[model samples]
Target chain A: MKPTTLRSFLPRPAINQRICISRVSRGYAVQAPGNPTLQVFNRNTKYLQKERAASNVERSRQADYLKDEVAMRLSERLLDINRHFNHVLDLGANSCNIARALTLPDPDIDPSKTTSPPLSTRISHLTAADSSRTLLYRDVDLPFNQEINLTRQVLDDEERLPFEAETFDAVLSSLSMHWINDLPSQLAQINHVLKPDSPFIAAMFGGDTLYELRTSLQLSDQERRGGVATHVSPLADVRDMGGLLQKAGFKMLTVDVDDIIVDFPDTFSLMRDLQAMGESNAVLGREPGGIQKDVLLANEGIYRELHGNEDGTLPATFRMIYMIGWKEGPNQAKPLPRGSGQINIKDILGGGEVK
Target chain B: MPTRISPIEKFAKAAAKCSVESSAYGKCIVVDYNSVHKDKCLTEFLRLKNCYLAAAKKP
Candidate 1:
């Protein structure tokens, strides 16, 4: 009862948040809904039809949430699965994965049932916005396009979002938000979006990803050269990421990390997947602009030598963390009426106090 | 024995976020919760989300 504080929850999302006012802005413009300046809204009518069809497919799709058995076990100890949310926001909801996995329209439950409300009935409206890799993907039906809205907009790390504070029921992100360099400020913006007692859920790759690649490059450089060698860009650690969440004011914080080994037959296959997914690291503070081929080749060689086995295929480890936190309400409350255990029925009977 | 947030209080918070300005209307009265959202109201409104998810998994 004492309005469960942040300590009671798991997977604090504030770790990945980064908010900052930008002196530099990128190519941006608003395309009118119809007469489009950009091609995103081109086939609005066609999109509506495709969206309708996609929803039919989504109704049956079982969302693949997590593969790690340990993460699944840890998550059971973390999330308050029964807590009902009203206003949910999907921050950087690429392909609408997490939203389909969670959210219910009729939160008030019948108690006997196991599943949430159906896709059509649950989740009042889910708004999924991301800077379009192609404006074409907006209506492009992939897998989980259900009753949701898509938009093309750049998220400012420092400034407040277009929406008001304490408005969303819950804000969720999966495999996104780490791109932000000013992660702390973004966490505050997430806090600003939720109403008191709301929750934020998120998942992101931890810093340990590509370590074999990083380490191999470092050792090779040390042996032949003096300086540290550049390899795969690193991710944030789970403990450091969690500290950022606490600083963002999210209570009941919890973070869980899962080590997933990814096998790549070759580097080109891995790079292609990264490009299609728009996952090339975009950290703003990197030294300079432009990529080189020789450096990349050397880096790959180093990574392979460190993590490869006799089979020749390379192994890359990806650590993913899922976090959550609550927007603290005024004055936490405790259940069972504070200290109601002091009274004794035997004392009342002996004193003849029965009415 | 406890503080139970009224259903209406909880619902209004959920409903108010979906209330947006009508694109067609002039600034006369921008907030358009009535006509624009009426048909798809259940789609974004909590009154329907619970039903869809709870039944989605059932055989």
Candidate 2:
């Protein structure tokens, strides 16, 4: 990968090694709302080298922490949504969370295999792909159908997937895929890998999810300065997500937003959680960790005034979507078309029509 | 001293065991899910490889 392309590509930080240094159109001058050009802080090369030297062990430790648990549940969920999958591929399967989810037995497993596939029935082959070598090597000793890590990005538009066309039975990406700068292009690449009847699932963070906090920050920024620059890069809406999946040659697409409301002792705890998860938005065009201590305080006040309930615990919302789509193929079931003729309410009532 | 499994090894084992259905890894994971160890089950499951606890709360 060219340095330009590699740097330009949206980063999918492995486990928790996410640190983005933002350099706007101008040099050292950064552009964020409420502040014309904030100073680039803490992310200097020296700092990074120091950080790397300091916490190289911690970086691996973080990856090691949740390997088994994530894989189990993810495997289960994948199994539930995808029936009759012979081959499965997991993208950036960090500690294999979705893979773990896929492993869980399907609730709809047929008893006695009553003219149906048995429950917790394994896929014929499983493939795990990621850019992290430490993570890639972790799976080397483990038992997988066949794990592939040498291949960097399955969605490489230039070469595409190395696997044969119509090869994979299913493809699942959880909390990843959004990191790609060219998401649509990558999605198209993924479409290529999956067999026509395969299932595609992606669980990702969406725009309206952290509305309370985002809105509060915006308001505060406006109050502090004349205008605000975009902080959080918006996610594909539910409708767009479904359309994207469908356009990627998928059918039977479903996008369900799982709104999880979390209670925090205060806003600080929520921010801490986001930090711990390495989920801080990294819009290359946007500025990093806000400047102006007073502005942050003002933002906090705004958040408290608007979103804080009487209990003093600020409500934090994460708008997440559990989406699934099926690859279009000859064997795939076609969807039924809706009748174009409008319904007649008066005729159906019969009270209005004597006949 | 007792055996102190490295967190990396621990998580790797967990992820492998979690995602595998009938794959090579599944055979190793004896999901000791029983009456007394519910939270442990949940935590262990959450910790499973690539298994995302989407709606999981801080217990």
Candidate 3:
């Protein structure tokens, strides 16, 4: 008797139909034309910056502090939902931070014992997508990587995602959406790719991020050069995010803000760290010649005078906006129609007897 | 009604007006990127920035 395979058991017409279906599904990954008016960031420059930062292993490691912290916070938020995601997409994933956070045992838990539930129990498989190839492969050889199913894909967040509709069980992003030029379109795409009622959790820098640095730089420029240049990139306001998510067709929206204040010895150290983190300004039409030394010196003094701690360290504020929205689905909970309630407000409050 | 141009196009047009200064500044920054100092490309930067600002102000 001849050895038989599962594919061989299928009829020839069935195989041809499967191939045709796959081809049609693959063609659904279309790239939408982005609006040019909203192009505030130079994505090419941002990519080059990320590549350059990732070239130095030591510096990049030092710079991973912010991303790591944000990733941990995002993972904690994911765990709160108590839903197990079979397949998740980590959009704009930097070095698989979310994957690492999920797989690695909690610091407070004992490693040998299984008393506390593992965080990775929440996610079965994660697809970590990022624009920078170097950043994506930075931690490929980590030991914890073996514990989870993680796949890395080099993807530009500025462009339309190359995924089929309703492909992801859930989508999570950390400290990446702020760099995007068209956030509404991105959010809609994210919603489109998520399974029904699946959560889309994300964190982005808010408008108040680095305000101290922004003001100091402006003051320095005005005093020295008689005019101020756009030094800091603009960020999304927390107030606008909920509206954007609602407009994107997500239901049960939750938006909150957090501030991470990091202390540095001086301005130069802070700037160096920002550069190493690939968070340097990528705004179009920005000053090509970097900040002038005299202006920087003046800004250092101004920064210290305005916002320096008593210990002499300069504090840089990073305001983060965390948002959670679920894709609309039929099985999800729905609010009752207005005036449909049976109970009276006065009766519920016990202020007056029911008529 | 006049056609409205995108911000990227407007910036691109302004940048084209100051290409010489922009190239000079770009070259300076790229050359000394690794060991760039505070005042490394002060002149080039200021010139390009001023030119671009002036160009951007025009209708």
Candidate 4:
């Protein structure tokens, strides 16, 4: 599929289509009430479905560049926990990357002469869910375990999960949830579906991701276009992850940032890589015509001056934030109630007895 | 909710008044929206934008 701009997907005008100009636009006499702002990253599912389909095709060429690495990292976290996950749900499981990584037989334990249980034995069932049916159906063969049962479902939407309460032992999403507009609501749904004390681990791009590209684009656009437009989608902040987990009633929440930098020959190559990875800008507010040639050429200079290496290659940073939360249950640890601690902080600091 | 000028129309309007400005790095056509529209209503904005695009050379 060809790379798309905002104008490429704009609905074609019908002959009888009614074009209503707002009253506010009639005369500027009295300012009409401003429309409420939409939630950031609030994109239509149809656009995403199409975009993901294109991306899945490109993913074959780039085979495991960013997605596979992140999925493996997320899978390793699950492996380290040493807990038996009977049923695992890979939310936003595009092409079952996470599921495949999680269920593949451990390299250390050979199935032919395995004295110990393989990693595939830990998870009996894997349900892979994604918004794009194109992605789920594109590839038929999977490197999944023969013993494990794998099911694929096209989710209705990210904000609303269709599953019974306490259905999953673990829920994992790799570099997918950042596109969601209502993250807290999504987290609540994930929390509801997870069995008590079960784990929910996710990895997503962080706020500082692609700062080099963003700065260059803004500067180039401001200089050439008189004003800057939204060229890149905003990523989630690491600090906000903890609060969101708590709001969703998840306990033992942990959020960590992993920064990865990839070197590129130039801005053009970098942009090509983004296109190949299916990570190009798709936000509604992005420029309709896409990046102008001049802006891109100008950005190359700025990119090299600031972020370039001695080898004449530039760097692109991808900050992945890993978030882990556990569903609240009787077995989960709880914080101490107010004034319930045995020792007072004042006594320990002052070396004096408490009253 | 009241409808506003869509993003496509806004981009086209911005592209119309564009003039190629040369810099140290390169040159690009910069569209000055403030100079063109000032403070127009949504309806007026779209009308004036269509007119501007119709008259000006395509960016």
Residues A178-203 of candidate 4: C-alpha lDDT, one tens digit per residue: 77777888899999999998999999
Q: Which of the two, 2 or 4, has more DockQ? A: 4
Tell me the docking grade of candidate 4. incorrect
Clash count in backbone of candidate 4: 2
Task: Report, to 2 decimal places, the DockQ of model 3.
Answer: 0.03
| Candidate 3 docking quality: incorrect, acceptable, medium or high | incorrect
Model 2 stretches with alpha carbons more than 4 Å out = A1-84, A104-121, A133-164, A289-291, A337-355, B1-59
Predicted structure with the largest TM-score when compared to the true one = 3
After superposing candidate 1 on the true structure, give the runs of residues whose Cα lies further than 4 Å from its correct spot: A1-79, A100-122, A133-139, A147-160, A217-231, A284-291, A331-355, B1-59
What's the lDDT for residue B15 in model 2? 28
Per residue, candidate 1 scores C-alpha lDDT tens digits across B4-50 of 75433343233222222111111111133122222222222232234
Candidate order by DockQ, decreasing, is 4, 3, 2, 1
Native-to-model Cα distance after best TM-score fit, residue A265 in candidate 2, in Å: 2.0
DockQ scores of the candidates: 0.01, 0.01, 0.03, 0.05
Residue A186's lDDT within candidate 1 is 70
Candidates sorted by TM-score, best first? 3, 4, 2, 1
- Could you tell me how far off, in angstroms, the CA of residue A180 lies in candidate 2 after the best superposition? 2.4
DockQ metric, candidate 2 = 0.01
Residues A33-54, candidate 1: write the lDDT tens digits: 6422212112232223223323
